[model samples]
Target: MPKGQEGRGIIDACLQALGEVGAVGGWDSSSPDGVRLDGARLGVSVTGPVDPATGRLFTPPNTDSNLAGLDLGADLARSTGLDVRVDRDTNVAALGEHAFGAARGVANFVYMTVSTGVGGAVMLDGRLLRGVDGVAGEIGHISVDRVGPSCGCGRRGCLEAIASGPAIARRAGDLAEEGGPLHEILASGRALTGKDVDECAAAGDIAARLVLESAARAVASACVDMANAFNPELIVIGGGVAIAHPQWISRACECVAREALVPANRAGIVVPAQLGDDVSLVGAAFL
Candidate 1:
């Protein structure tokens, strides 16, 4: 159900289970690990470590890191007796969005998810950018602050480290434990979750506001950087935290428009994601 590298196995299991349920109608789903049907084969495109001129992924073995998903999908598909399709999650999300979500009529747009980690998808001229290796929108790994916190990817100050839901919650939890205003506010036995922090911030709590503001600023900075790099006409921000704070979204837009290169290109940009929790499922289904 959740999108992750492990989703390939889950999907395989689900497909096997579905075989016991008789004919499953056309279903819509999404997952970061890609998708498969009962009868189709899987394929993946990737940019290997090898030079394009050599047509080899690497020097010796000719392996490509980006095509790992494709290889895995194919193997799993054969074992599970079902067809598999592997592609980058962001590209799949973009296709799902363009086909049935907020960017339906748009020709160019970006879809971003700010959850446990940041992820993105881009659509240009109504077509998703699969990239040479199909791993196009790996925005979460983008280094935002060279001196900031380290990411799971062993990098420092990534957009994900600063703006993801888990990052915000962890920071809020740390702040709450500092025995300051946050502790005083949460003394009523209401746990100070990220959602609680957002609520308190919205209610004018200074300490909570500070935590949220810090997170928002980080997200805003990253958004600005992304806008400057891509100059997309629209960016749809999804994920639990973004959905919780409309003000944060607005502030991020303001920050990006003010600081991004070619600010004029930032105009008419809207922040909205049509699918809520179902985005991944829908995207996977499309895959």
Candidate 2:
């Protein structure tokens, strides 16, 4: 929760949840051979603006900064008395999908997350592609238009700047000022979200549908670029907005097929993740 308390609460919550259904035990980290791991090993998947080499986060965006620069992996291992492996949340999620979800048995694929922010993970030739500093999948930062909106990363035209959940909300707010259907979606003190847009669109709200379509097209453009450039066997889409609007997934796949190099041979497929929420959890397990 604070400096040196990285991931402690989550670990505790997980153990508590495990306790609800079965036996639980705490062993000493110092003496690994003293006892069994209760038949299951544990790992943690953490997100951030982080330094993967050190497991230290760069002042986490919009969240508590106290835990920044802490080694959550070492801390969890010390605190939980279990073998712990840590990596970017997206990386582990990719692992989860590859091992048990949508990308199961696929040798090469890319996983993209579109939510409050956009993030991605690359799995090629059966390995995760972590860049020099383990900061590889900055797909959201890929510039789509040189003059587009400014991203928090201090760059303009980043895919995330134009297509993330907050981006949709911001667009909705702007439209609300124009005295349209978006006004009914957001009232005083009520924050419009990508999910709100999705729900509203599903009910035949024209303005809401437009907002989603725009976001979907931006996402599709990015995915198409990845398909042509990265050339993975598949590109798996997940996260809040993509989940809320299933059609966006199909739209993205269709776009890639039409624009990219032989998708049937190179890009393989573009689809929704099968793991759902368990994507990250199963990924942590694999780690």
Candidate 3:
């Protein structure tokens, strides 16, 4: 899978999988339209927002323009000759959780992922909230600090800029420069990760604790806001950073309880995702 050929790569993989399953016949790889996977449906979970009406992706923050305005569902449908459905990765993940994970049987809930980047999906009254443009639930861009660091979305102090995995590493790196346990790890010439920060904090490293605490506060603030806005029954936290650190989830739950509106706090409870990495995979099937 080479750069600039991701679309082709996905189609090839789909075709190969269909062929292996006896759902498609022999086809020329070069001619994607040579054959069809009749009656088969494909679901694509993408990294950015997608217009449900047109099935085209919006210009994602800090991403290649090629993805912007691209009708991925149409392209994949044409290439693989299968019914293709597409939506933001987080949105599908919410569906997955609602159908089989922590949010199961919950009618109103929020799903947030704190992995490579922070993202969220809102399910209200048992339905996904696709805004007028079909790109709602972009809580990552919510500004926690108006004067804080710049985000890839060209905003100042976005939650993603402060609490994403990369953000956690960046925060740790800043402390590392001042000579701390994080610095000792950096001295080993190994790049830092969110997991590293979690481990360091678990070991009682002051710098790591400070960094993680700051990130947790930011996340909690966002959760409080979401609780007030949606009054969800649960706020399901997922992704690498959250799963790696149960303390982070606990901290957010505490914050939400302490800071959110009385009714919202009483109604909303933050919890961990149960499906692990298979959340999106299972969700896509539901789509």
Candidate 4:
């Protein structure tokens, strides 16, 4: 959600993309701040693990603590001067898949995003499951290891703690000083990104290879657990990490097929999300 040369937020990007596509008017959505824009017919802002009932992000994880009590949804509706619908990003992405992407004909599926953070949305029997607090499908917080690194959600060994982009990048940067190949890779003095790990692994950097492989295995294990629990027909993967490394889906599929229960194993489908980056926006529109 960083701004561009002209201080463009996701809304600005959406506006430009809409213009290029000759959209008469369109809705904008993201998990960040409100912004100025022109030509948008409606605006949708999906912010936080917030309460839809109160539009408040009370003690939200992975967001500014100051946003804890803000009425993000109502605020956006005011600034945009058009109706603004708010929901969790994961749910929106799941809706996008159901309405316009890979799960077109399917009735049950899980939409997971593996980028800065890991999250998921679940649809069962043709309905999105919004739990009591609209916080269903919070797969990122599912603890995978009891003693692994701590997560932003204040938990240890959560899937996102060990397998997310930042998590992978943080581990790579920490091990960069271990000597040999990684030393040179960290010469830039900043940090190694998840993509950097992939590139270095491709060039035979042992540390990078290990980090990527470990992340892949973590992803596979987590997906296997989900397959067993949800018994969904499909798990559509998206987000920066999945797009950057298409192999994740295949690796996860291999693991799920081998590890999940007989019926669940046969039913699960792991595939890349079809709407790509647009799933969030498309899903918000449905909201």
Q: Pick the candidate with the highest TM-score.
A: 3
In model 2, which range of ten residues has the least summed lDDT?
27-36
Per-model TM values vs. the true structure: 0.72, 0.82, 0.87, 0.82
Each prediction's RMSD to truth: 7.2, 4.2, 3.2, 5.3
Give the per-residue lDDT of model 2 (tens digit) for 110-193.
999887778889988998888777778878889886787777777887888778889888776776544445676566467887
Q: Please give the distance, in angstroms, between residue 233's alpha carbon in candidate 2 and its true position after superposition.
A: 0.9
- If both were scored by TM-score, which would come out higher, candidate 3 or candidate 4? 3
Those runs of model 2 whose alpha carbons end farther than 4 Å from true positions after fitting are 1-41, 49-53, 61-64, 202-207, 262-268
The per-model lDDT (C-alpha) reads 0.62, 0.73, 0.81, 0.72
User: Lowest-lDDT window of 10 residues in candidate 4?
Assistant: 1-10
> In candidate 1, what are the lDDT values of residues 62-129, reduced to their tens digit?
12233332344545565544555555545555666777887778787778777656777777777766
* Residue 13 alpha-carbon offset, candidate 1, angstroms: 3.0
Instruction: Output the better candidate (1/4) by lDDT.
Output: 4
- How many residue pairs clash (N, CA or C atoms closer than 3 angstroms) in each of the candidate models, in the order given? 11, 0, 0, 0
